[model samples]
Target: MSWVPVAVSLGFAGLTVLACCSFKVFLGVRRFGRELERTKRRLGPKHAALRDELHDLPEPRAARSPGDGVPSV
Candidate 1:
């Protein structure tokens, strides 16, 4: 019965450490997510501009003759 208190104390300490580590990891992930959102926001306008520029470019045509694939009469 004497060892029970020691075991309980050790278990509680272990759990506390585990919880602290988990909370730290959660905070880091949250910070990373916030930074990622900020980056996307900053790039969104540039991405849209580039997309518009691409849309304004002329389309390329195939090099083959128009009647090359037609069947003989």
Candidate 2:
């Protein structure tokens, strides 16, 4: 039928568009992964320093009693 060629052409065009979109998405994901790795590397030392500082802090005190020279509502 005459419509068969038109159908085949449309199918090919659709596939081409889909493939291009897929490639673009793949590249974007790869770039994002690289940026994430770079950021992690840059902040690794700062993160470790903050973690160490947190550990060096003193422990919390026990809860105070309301009757310790204070009024108990």
TM-score of 2: 0.85
lDDT of 2 at 56: 96
lDDT by residue for model 2 over 1-73, one digit each (tens)?
A: 9999999999999999999999999999999999999999999999999999999999988877766676756
> How close to the true structure is residue 60 of candidate 1, measured as C-alpha lDDT?
80
Global lDDT of each candidate:
0.96, 0.96
lDDT of 1 by residue, 5-57 (tens): 99999999999999999999999999999999999999999999999999999
Error of 1 at 28 (Å): 0.5
Q: Which 10 consecutive positions of candidate 2 have the poorest summed lDDT?
A: 64-73
Q: List the residue pairs that clash in candidate 1.
A: none
Model 1 Cα shift for residue 23 (angstroms): 1.0
Model 2 residue 14 lDDT score: 100
Candidate 1 lDDT trough over 10 residues, lowest sum: 61-70
Clashes of each: 0, 0
